[model samples]
Each structure stands twice: as C-alpha cells, then as structure tokens.
Target: MSAGDIILIPNRSDNYIYLLRCAKSGVTAVIDPGDAAPVIDELEKRGWQLDIILNTHHHNDHVGGNAELKEKYGAKIIGPTAEADKIGGLDVTVAEGDTVKVGELEASIYDVPGHTAGHIAFYFPAVSALFSGDSLFALGCGRLFEGTAEQMWHSLIKFRTLPVETRLYCGHEYTLNNARFALTIEPENTALQARVSAIETLRKANRPTIPSTIGEEIDTNPFLRADVPLVGKAMGMSGATAEIVFTEIRHRKDNF
Candidate 1:
C-alpha cells in the first residue's frame, strides 16, 4: 500500500477531476469527473486504463462522466450509499466507515454532508490524501445547498481530526475567491494574509492552489476556525458556541 500518484485535471469552469494510480498495483481511478472529454484525454495521454470511477456526491458536475467512462472502460462506479438513487451507475455504494480498495491502495469513507446531503469523502491514509469533493475546500467549505450550517460544521470537524499533513484534494478551484472572502473575516490574521499573497501568485502563474494541507487550512481558513474564540470575537459574537459562530460565518459567506 504505497502512496499513489495523483494528477489534477481541470474541467468545466472550476471543477477538478483527479486521476490517481496506485504505486503498488498500478490501479488507476478517476475521482469526480465533471466531464468525460478531459478525463478520456488524460487517460489516453498516459496510456492507462481507467479501473474505477469514484464519486463523492450526486452533483451533475461530479458524476457527469460516469456513464461514458464506465461504458468505455467497463470501470466500476463507487459512490455514496446515501445518494445511490441520484448517482446512477454505482456498482458499489459506500457509507461512513466503509472501506474502498483500488488495487493495493485502500480508502476510508467519511460521510461529509453539507453542500449536498449524503456527500462523502475518500481518505487514503497510505498517501495522506483526502479527496474531499465539495465538502471542504482550500480556504472554505462548500455552500450549504441541501444541508444545514450545523451539519457543515460537523462535517468540517471530521476533516479537522485528520492528520494535519493530509493533502486535501477538493473538487473546485475557488481558493482565490475564498482567500479574499476569508480576509474580510479575519483582517489581522498573519497566516491568512500570507496565504492570500501566495494564492495571488499561484493564480497569476495559472497554477492550481490546491492540495492545501489540513494544517494550512486550520491556520487560515475561517470556516475551520469557527470554534476558536478569536473567530467568534472577530464576527462580533464573543463567547458564542461553535455552531452559532459557524452559522454566522456561513451566512456571511453566502452573501460574500
């Protein structure tokens, strides 16, 4: 169970499609393919056959390419059991505490419902990577479309418990905008300020500001810091509970 090699492929608008290959068994998988063309092109370029399609939620952009990829390569589609009806073509449906294997690599599933109820994340401890589709982002969490702020906060708490070094492979490229919005929340945070500068540089160079570690997010991401007293004070809600503070943060972000 060696660390796998993960490739980030940008897709429609800001969606991200990750292609991962197990170092030990050469198993290839695509995570949240928003479109089939880009995934197919990348697979052809690398001359690797797609072995599995791993989806996190039922969003159209997340599972859009499932049928085409499965049809072309006979790949198995593994997605969240809660969203089984919405996410068609799932050969294997998994829930929280379930384990999924890709060749010699294994991933633990976590139920992280926020942007969508029943959304799940895949954590490959062997590689210290979390393919967090739409639940947690670089400096923000996904919008609470079908779930509550409390639910999103709890979901983020699950992410916070992971090892700080875990590399977060989120589903979108919204770091730049998220950074700006985060600054509005914590104007004097030195770490957040420094991260903003770095994010600006990366976007200017047309580079992805992804794979942000959990430690980095914990330091600069306001969404993850809702439980901290400083964050509550900054929001003018001193001594508020984490859930109340988190709800305010989400409300501001929704309007930001």
Candidate 2:
C-alpha cells in the first residue's frame, strides 16, 4: 500500500467506511465502520492491525462496527465527547480543538454539530484531508437532523476557511443525488453540469464518489457556493442573503 493510502470500503449501499494506513509504520486506523465484515476482510487481507477507530457521530451507519472491531483488533475507540451517550465503547471522547494521532498523522477535531448535534470532522492539516461524516457531501450537505440551519451553515463555513486544496472524505456516496439537486440552484455552472455527468457515470459503474477536494467542491457544489448570485436567483429567492438562500435550498433538498 502507498504511504498514507486510503482504502474505501463500500458499506450499506450508500455509506463508506475508510481505512487509513500508514505505509511507513504499517499502522492502520479506520474512519467510521458501518459494518464489520468488510472492515474485517480488508484488515485480514493486509494482515494489518487496527490501531484506532475514529467515529464522527453515533449514527449506526458511522459506528455500527465499533464494538466488534474494538474487540477483535483491540483498537482504541475515539468518539466525539458531545455525543458520548450515543457512542458505544468510546475510550477517548474528543471535542473541538482536540488533537488525536493516527500513527504520525495528527487529526484536529472540529465540533460540527448539525447532522447529529455532535458530529465532528477530523482535519489532518499536514495531509490537507478532512473526514466529514454525514456533515458535508459532494454537491450537498447533511440534513438538519439535530441542528438549526444557522448552526449547520456556520459549521460548513468553518470548513470553507480551511486551505482550498484540502481533500474531503465524506461518509456516504450521495454524489448522484446531490449533483441532480445542484443543477436546480446553479444552472449557469457548466462546471457543475460536467461534474454531475461525471458523477452519474461513476454511479452507473457502481463506483464510489468520494475523496473530493475542497477546491473542486467550492467550484461545483451548490451548497458550498450559496454565495453565487446565479444560484440565489435560481432558487427563486432573489435579493435574499446567501445564508437565507442556502437554507431554502437545503429545505428543498430535504423534502425532495
């Protein structure tokens, strides 16, 4: 495996569980295990020992395999402290601004509460990677499950402030659906149109759409580009603030 190689394990049809392996150290840390079988298979295939399991939220699709993996590999279960009650067998509950290490890589946790009121994204500044679990998706954002629109907006903005080259590793494979809705808000964005076509092709091939970069998302993602004037006009909410328009767009997607 390449150094710092990310292996994506497709789970539950739409969800993705990732394994981050340090090629130099032979250490592996998994990010969200929705199922145990696939993770186990991957680990066994490589004869790797899981050092840590990172959980962004308590959602079953994110933490379902925690107990089993922790038991089998003796991996440390790291979860968000804000939703301690939701996570099982959490050995270390972290909060925003806290740092966790995966081999030589250091992940800085951000409290991005919206999808689950305690959802956190891990930022590896050195690698320019963000593990956004159900919070941000390509051409989309997570539903307002336990957070207000304003709160979610703020959380997303926090990510926007990161380096534009940062890579985003989201939890689910929702690119096709998100890309469809993106056109409603950004009809003038030919980049969005082209990206949507690419995503559609990937979906038809049953390939996972993930590991998108912040720059690409900024260019084509409607949710992340609510500040664009054309997007605001397309939403039928002219003269409205970007935040207001973004909320409306999110609502429309929620009901769709």
Q: Whose lDDT is greatest here?
A: 1
TM-scores for every predicted model: 0.98, 0.95
Each model's lDDT: 0.94, 0.87
- For candidate 1, lDDT tens digit of each residue in 114-183? 8999999999998899999999999999999999999999999998989999999999999999999999
- lDDT per residue (tens digit) for residues 180-211 in model 2: 88887777888888898888888899887788
TM-score of 1: 0.98
Model 2: lDDT equals 0.87
Which stretches of model 1 miss by more than 4 angstroms?
none
Query: What local lDDT score does residue 154 receive in model 1, on the 0 to 100 scale?
Result: 94
Candidate 2: minimum summed lDDT over ten consecutive residues — where?
Answer: 1-10
